[model samples]
Each structure stands twice: as C-alpha cells, then as structure tokens.
Target chain A: MGGDFGPQVTVPASVQALLQYPELKVILFGDQSAITSQLSLLNQLQHPRLSIVHCEHVIANETRPSQALRSSQGTSMRMALDSVSDGQADACVSAGNTGALMALSRYTLKQLPGVDRPALVTAIPTNTDNKTWLLDLGANVSCDADTLFQFAVMGAVLAEQENSASPRVALLNIGEEEIKGNDLVKRCAEMLANSPDINYIGYLEGNELYSGRADVIVCDGFVGNVSLKTSEGVANLFIDSIKNAISTNPLKRLVAKWLFNDLFISLKQLNPDQYNGASLLGLRGIVVKSHGSADVAAFSNAIGEAVHEVKRQIPTKISDRLEEVLLERHY
Target chain B: MGGDFGPQVTVPASVQALLQYPELKVILFGDQSAITSQLSLLNQLQHPRLSIVHCEHVIANETRPSQALRSSQGTSMRMALDSVSDGQADACVSAGNTGALMALSRYTLKQLPGVDRPALVTAIPTNTDNKTWLLDLGANVSCDADTLFQFAVMGAVLAEQENSASPRVALLNIGEEEIKGNDLVKRCAEMLANSPDINYIGYLEGNELYSGRADVIVCDGFVGNVSLKTSEGVANLFIDSIKNAISTNPLKRLVAKWLFNDLFISLKQLNPDQYNGASLLGLRGIVVKSHGSADVAAFSNAIGEAVHEVKRQIPTKISDRLEEVLLERHY
Candidate 1:
C-alpha cells in the first residue's frame, strides 16, 4: 500500500509514530483489510507498540524501477523492504514508490561497504544554523566522476551527523568557475578540489542551493533532481501567488486572514510537512523515502525520519565514514 | 561594457531604452570615456538617439570562452557582436561573458541553418497564460540526442513567438517518466514523440518548471543551467525567508507592512526584473543575454528584450521556422 494517502496516510502515520516513540515498534506492511480499515479509525487499535504484517501484494505507483526490482516480491513495497532486511526492522518508512522505494531499497538492503550506488539523501530548508545536505536526490540518473566523488562522501557523512563541526563541501556547479561545468562537472570539480579530507567547497550554483553555503551539496541524479524539484516549484509558485493575490481584495480578504496567519507562522519554518524524510543514502539498512504526496503531517515527518536514522546509527555511521574515506583515497 | 552594472547599469539602461523607443538607436560600446562620463551624469549629454562606439578592448569576466573568442577582438563585447554582424545592429544586448556571449555570438552571426549550437534562452515566470520558454540556459554543456532534438525545435519556435497557440513542447525530464531521463533524455523523448511538427509535451519535471504547463521548455546546457539557476535560487530563498520572518515582530513589523502589500503586488508579477532578457537561440543575429547582476530596472528589461527581438522578426521567424522544420526532417 503505497502513498497518495494509502492507509489513509500510512495508518494515521503509523499510529502517530507509535505515540511519539516510547521505544517505538510498528510493523504494518499493508492491506490487511486496507490496513485494518485505517487501523479501525485509529483509537490506536490495541496498541502495544502496534503490529500488522499481512501485506498481500500492492506496490504499483506505476511500478517499473526495472520492473519493481524484479517483480516486487510479496509487495507492501516489498514487505516494507523485507522488514528492514529481516533483522526485525531497526528502520523502514516509505509513503512509497519513488521508483518502488528506490528499487526495493536497493534490492532489499544492500550497498554499504564503501558504498557504490545508493544516494538519494535530502534536507534543504536553509537560511542556515543548519540544513543543506542534498545529494543524488533521484538516485543515479547518470552520475560519474566517481559517482560525484561518492556523492561528496555521502554528503559529508550526512552533514557530519548534524553536530556539524566542519561540514561545508560543494560541487553542484554550473560556474563558481574552475572554468564552469561539463566534462562531468569538470571532473567533479576535480574530485572535490583534491579532497584534502573533504571540507571541499570549490563550487555551488543553482543559486547556491539555499545559500547556507554548503554543508554537503553534491549533484548528479539529474542535477540533484533538478535542484530538488526546483525548490518545490518555487515554493509552489509563492504559495499560489499569495493565495491568488489574497483572493482579489474583498478588502484583501479581510487583510488576508491576518496576513495568512502571519505567513503560515513563518511558513511553518519552511515546511514540506516539516521536511518529511528522504535518506536512502548509501544504504545497508535504514530506508526513509516518504513524499509520494505524503500527508497525515507528511507521513508523520516520514516517521520522524525513520526515528532519526534509528537513533543515529545511520548505517553504522555510513559504514564507518565510508571506510575511512575509502581507505584514505586508495580507491 | 558588459554587466555587473557596467556604465552604471548600461548607461542608465541606454537612457531608458532611448526613452522607450521612438525607433530606438543606441551604440555606446564601452569606454568612450566610461560612456561619456555616464552620459555626463545623465543630463542626457547630447542624446540624439545616442551614439558613442569608442571601444577600448575589454572583456574580462574571467575570460576564456576559448580565450574570449580569441582575444575579444575589439572588445565592447566584440563591438556588440560586430554590431549584430554588420547589419549595424538590429539586436545585441549583453550583460557580458555568458561564455563570452556564446562565443562572440557564434563567431559573428553564424548558425541558424538547421542550427547546431546556440541555445541559452530564457523567460520563465509562469502560472501560465504566458512565460516559460527555457532552453540550453548555459549553452551546450553536453547535449546529444541530436542536441535535444534541436532543443525541441528551438523551443517550439520560441513558443510560437510567445503567442503560444500550439506550443506545449517539453523534455526537461528528471521524471514525468517515459522511463525518466538519461540516454540523452530517452533519446530526446523519442524525437519529441515522433514529431508531427512540434507540440511535443511529454516529460517535464523539476516540478513542472513553474507548473504553468509547458510552453516549450527543452533542456541540456547542464540541465538548462540547473533549471535556470534553480529558479533564481528559489526566488532568492523566498525573498530571504519572508524578510527574516517579517523582522521578528515589532507587532510583526506593523503587521508586516499591511501584509507585505498584497504579497509584494503578486510578487511583482514574478519579477527577476520582469524577466530580464536571455535569448541566444539558434543565432544568425539577435543576441540579448542580460543579467550579469542586472539593475538599472534590470537593464531596462534587457533593453526591452532587445526591442522585443528586434520587433519580432526574430531572425525572420527563426530562419523561416528552421527552414521549414529542417526541410520536413530530411534533416
């Protein structure tokens, strides 16, 4: 049962992430009578950290990520990526079908050793005291220069696990001129300007991807999904041209409902449902994904980004910092 | 001579496009004593439809478009592309060095015979009912699929001269899938889905490039200059985060100046200085470019888009509809 309000928005966003994580556990995987009739209209259907597991096949938001990674095996998005590849789920969230949740989360949890393919990462909201991250947001729609130097070292170790001591890094490029792009973004900005243990920074255009001057940008998943869906289509054409210019002046809709309730309370601090999840970075366990038109508060912020990448064991910290920066560039 | 407000914003934007075109005539071409000392500080220093032409070999916004078309021969952006290739200028606006004005306007007015290289177009504002041309906004940075089927027949003959009766066209693709991109955008969306003489409209994503539903759009030139500088860096981060959340409340900046005055008058109708010029399309004379940090009313709307593509002759309607669609595809 993939997105577009699937179990009426993933069963009340998995019973509100099992009532905000008191050691959360949800195992839903799909259509056991349409997720138990949306978890029997949610009075937390007998909720001892919830459970469902019935999944009799579903996956089609027009399937085809190489034919749903070889025929979506018993699909509730491949049994929620086979319950996080069988070790009884540390993390798995979907909203589903972003190319069948990135080809069944890279064919049921694979890729982590000094990672070669898994990239899609996200997070952009910027003015800065943290939030830039980007990556191969569409997952390898033609990358190179060593998979954009391993998507700038897994977007600088996921922005240095947000504690951010020295993040920066860049390379989305179309001019910050080392003779601007092509020839594979000038050989991925000459391998992030000769690595030097990666605080790189040489280039970043597409209008400085939310100008929080780089805490890992990188590109190549079709220019990071066209610079993250052209900044969500210019913030949905500036909130539909300010609600069609305040519904054409019935005294500017009574002063635009106190100016769109003080601009949607500071645009709910740049909310795409409070930045719903994306991760799928160099994979080997955690899956995240979300936005297949996510709702119920953006699939409970993609189950609070798979419980913050399973309490920060973000795939053993990107497989121990991509095996110590690929054995110190012995690549 | 070339942007960053050269001659204090192109000599008061060529004296406000010769006071809004009474058959306008300009010709200043740089350093005629820093443009007659900025038209002797704009007291209209002898402005009989203006003329200056002093040119002292300049071109240096970090040169190299093959060394600025071989030593920027007689500079002022090469005598304004040799005064539109000797027809003494019907069109040629510049904000300098867009790869040295597409290599001296393709080494002086060349291409346009079933054109090969020269796309960098513009015009984006779109909630439709106009605006959305796009193109190789950075000029040929790795294109192929027959240069994106000749940028979808020169962006559907410049969106059918912006009247757009049958324009729709498309291609930009990072997924509005027909097997989403790469493989040169699926062999240029199978030559605009078997051509029927252009109105293509298949793949579109990058959030439907301002969801004003495709009136041409095309791609390449590094994903059309990262989808036109990521929609000018998401309209400069939504006008610097709604002016830092309406300046942290002194009664919310006196109720955010009457609710940001009808959302900045419908965001000044999606202004980037009212879409300041760009059009370098399949050459044969008509240049445009602007915005190297444009400012005198956005270089008088890039000299009113080079007097609206020299009064819409637009290189005799794109060399007679690209020589009747390249002789009805006999290429």
Candidate 2:
C-alpha cells in the first residue's frame, strides 16, 4: 500500500531479511488482504515471528506532509513510525512519501532537544575504498550559521559511528579558500576550526566529494540534494551512453557480452540501490527512508541498514556528544 | 606563469588559433624572449600579424584578488584585459587564476550598472545535440532573489544568442515542485514565471541538468560550482573505473582497443576541454576563463570562444536588455 511496488517488494525483502537475521521479528502494517495475498503466495502466511496489523488507510505518494499529519493516523507509514516511538519496534524503515514520512515521524516522536529539524544523511561512495556521509540531502533548504554548525556536530557524531573512527569533517563550499564562501559558511568554518572535539577540515569543493578529501561533508539541504542528484544523473548518463554505444552495432554488441560482465561488476559496486537507506538524523527514533523506486534487493539493503543503526545506538551516541558540547559551552 | 603549463601550452595554442583564423592578430603579453623562442619553434615569430609586447610582470596563481587589483597593472593577465578595455582587441582570454581574472576584468572595465558582480557561465554538453549554460560557477556564493532573476535574464540572453532561439530558463532546485526550494529560490521562480521576455519553465531538479530539459540553469554560486565540479569528478571516476576494469584482464584489454573506439568518441564529444571557455557575464567587456590545466587544443577552443563572443556582440545585447528591464520597472 506504500512505495512504488508496495508489499510486492517489501514483503519479499522482509522474508529475505528474516533469513539473514534469525532472531528478527517483523510486524507488517498494511491492508490485511494485500499482505495476506503475498504471504500466502509464498506460503509464509503461518511463518513464526511474523504478524500483520490490518491497516486500511494508505498514504499515497502525492499526499502532502500537512495532509498526511492531519488525517493519516491509521496509515501504514504513520503506524510504522508510531511502533518505533512506543517501543514496540527497535527501528522503522519505509519507502513511502518522503515528506509525509518525515512529518509523521517528527510529529510522532518529536525532535530531540536542541534539534530544530532532522537532516537526511546518506553514504556516497568515493574513489577511496570508503564512502563519504553527506548530510541535509534535501531537509532544510536555507540554513543559518548556527543551524549549519549543528549539522556539523550531528554529522561528526554519525560519521564517527559510521567510519568506526573520529571522522574528518569539512564544510561543502565552492573553493578551499577561507574567503571563498558566503558569510554563513565562513562563520561555520571558523567555529568548526576552533572546536576541539572533532576533526574539522576547513572547506571541501564539490569536485573533492569523491576525491576522498573528507569523511563527512556538510551543507544546506538544497546544495546537498542537488549535488547528490546531479552525481546520479551524470552516472546514469555515462552508463546509458555506453550501453547505447555498445548496442549501435553487432561488433560492439558481441564485445559487450563480455565487456558488460566486468563493467557491471564495477558499476554494481557504485550502485545507488546498494546504498539505499538515508538516516533521518536528529530524530528521537530511528527512521530509514528507502528510495521510493528501490527494488527488492535495494529495499533489503535499507532493512539491513536499519538493523545496523539500531544495534549501534547511533541516536544515543549523538545525544551524549551534544550534551558534552553543551556542557563544555556552559563551563 | 599562472596555469600548470603556462606559456608552453599557451604559445603553441595561440599559433594554432592564428592558423585557424588568418585575419586574426595576436599580441603576445609576457617575457619577450620566451615568446620569441616559442614562436620561432613554430616558425611564427616573424609572422606579420603576430606582435610581442615585452611585459616582465606575471600574475602568480596564488595571488589574492585584492592584491591583483591593487598591484597587477603591468602583469600579462592585466595587460591582456586592458587591450580589450581600450578596444585594441576584440576580447580577452586567459588560463590564469580565475579569481584574479574576474577581479582584474571587473576593476579594469567596471561592472555594468545594475549588476553587483558578474557570474561564471560555461556550456555543458548534454544528451541532446545542444549544450546547457550554467551560471555563477564559483563567483557569487549567496544570491538574493533579485540576483537570481538577473542571472535568468542574463542567461536567457546568452542562450538566445548562443542558440539562435529563446532559451528555456529554469531555477535549479532539489525538486521540480513549486514548494521544493527555499524562500529565496521560490520567490525567484515566481518572478521568472511572470516575466514575459524569456521562456521560464519553473523549477528543475539537479538530475535534469544533463537531461537537456532546459537551456539555461541558474543557482547560487555555491550550488552551481559544486554541481559543475561534481559532474566532472563523477565523469572522471566513471571513465577511470572502467579503464581499471578493462585493464584487469588480457581479453578485456584487447576488446578495449576496439571496444573503446566509440566510447572514447562519445566521451571526447562530452569532454570539458571541447567546451572550455567559461564566460564572465555582466561585465562591460568580454572575458573568458580557460581551465588552468587546459591543453593546447583546449586553450585554442577558449580563444575561439572569445572570438565568437566578440563577433556575436553578446555584451552589448545584454546591456540593452538590462536597460529595457530597468525601464520596464521604472514605468
């Protein structure tokens, strides 16, 4: 009843997740008939550790955030978030409408203290073996100096956990000079440089995102989202262009049979679907937003990310770091 | 002296440009002896149309904009710009420091009235036969709604002149919806929609930049620079990864010879060098900034672009449009 393919993909992905994690339990919240039909098709209707809470209302993709919050109490997306808030579930994952999902999760769990709005952070693969975590994917379009500073702190905490070390952070800017960015970015850079709690690498240009100059790159949601989407667009153009070129003639097509073998293996390594889940940071509970167009394998990866976040206690760690910074300021 | 290769590339490139346009005359601005030696090597030293201006001062890449404006009067970069300002040359092209060039040009010629600062706009090849022009490459970091609207008008004029038709202008944002961007971007969109001169298509996402949906895309310099640089980084990464994969095996390497034939052709067509010159729009005189690491061919393309701008009378047309816009507002 949600996402592009709804239970068709999520149900199979859940079964796959259950296979991977033996101790896992799943409570699906969607139309009973839709869930039953799929479960019965796979003969998983009587599977142990799986339950369905019949939910009639579905949050459509076109539903506005305000409308969803006003009348989506019984919606699957809302119930899933509520399950996490009420301690019935350890974490929640959804491929529903992003705006509605964010609104409902914030409305249900409320933002953590000292956080105005949660930012979306996702891992983008770089030329280096590791990936860079970019925050505010499309959360807050325009941010003040303080809000940007807060994103740095939150992003640093997440990157530390994600990288299993103290992450080197840099403000995303046009140039690497102290005078390159606007006043807001310059102010944020100065504050981060003076702070002693994190590794604050001054400024990183967009060309440096995949050049592996920083572990965490922070910017306002508008720039972050545009950069991320533009990267994807170029990548698609590259691959599609190659495919069309290979298909242009029989000789190239013959070569593509083997050429595509290793080409795809490398391409698969950089697939956006392989890194589908984006964490809604600064929220009180864990909520992972899977790309709406994600398929079974991609949705499975999102579920895995949710499981990993729950185990890592990422929110708790961020809370502690925030408190430490706040108490230091008070002192 | 400023770019990576400097006169070694520039001198040969100037010779190549002169060969293409026989009526073209060049004034070499740098050390007289170095220019003489390079010209002799190409048998271009005594060419009647080629003249050498002995200028010992060279602008270093590391020079700050303020320092360049205050003390770089005698430097080659500044002299080249002066030639254009005095109407001795049709236009100026340089592979020098971008910040310094922008500063020196603005200070020497003065900005057009009603223009705060000029923006860096470059043509990017798209899937379609035509190219898209993205502005504020790394010039102004933060722009108000009025500034953004100005970019649209400037970009629209440039695109119309470049494409010989009214170009579709768009505001680059995270989403295509009207509610997608910040307050500033939203307000700018509204003004563009109401404007009757250009074809305003409203909001466009970053993914659509290379999709050839719009002819001119506008954004704050920070986002524009990042998007441009990020696209370059990804394109490089895509090619490099495929090269590594193909080189891993002998069979793949053999196929790559023939396999890479059309692939390289398509890539070369999309090469940034082929579209090298970035126009510094909103200035009284025409100036083009070439990539610092550009080769002889790329530098030649930049020079060609400058000549084209001079012939097209782009700056005069933009000035007229600005006056028209101002008069409309006055009424």
Candidate with the greatest DockQ versus the true structure: 2
* Per-residue lDDT of model 2, residues B83-200, tens digit only: 8899988788888888889889998887877677788899888998778889878888878888888888888888887664889998998862323889888888888887777689
Q: Give the per-residue Cα lDDT of candidate 1 at A48.
A: 82
Top lDDT: which candidate number? 2
Give the C-alpha miss distance for residue B222 in model 2, angstroms: 0.8
Best by TM-score: 2
Per-prediction DockQ: 0.21, 0.65
Which pairs in model 1 have colliding backbones? Answer: none
Error of 2 at A152 (Å): 2.3
Fraction of true contacts retained by every candidate, in order, equals 0.56, 0.62
**lDDT by residue for model 1 over B1-331, one digit each (tens)?**
8877689888998898889888989888888888888899988889888888888788877777887777887888888888889998788888877887888888888888777887878878888678788888777778788877877787777777775658888877786242378888888787678778888878888877877788877888787787678777777667777777667667767766776787886676665445888888788888888878888877878888778778877767777876776677775
Q: What is the interface RMSD of candidate 1, in Å?
A: 10.3
For all predictions, the C-alpha RMSD in Å is: 21.7, 1.7
The residue-by-residue lDDT of candidate 2 on A106-133, one tens digit each, is 9998887777788888988888877888
lDDT of each: 0.78, 0.83
TM-score of chain B of each: 0.36, 0.96
- Return the TM-score for each candidate structure: 0.37, 0.97
Could you tell me which residue pairs clash in candidate 2? none
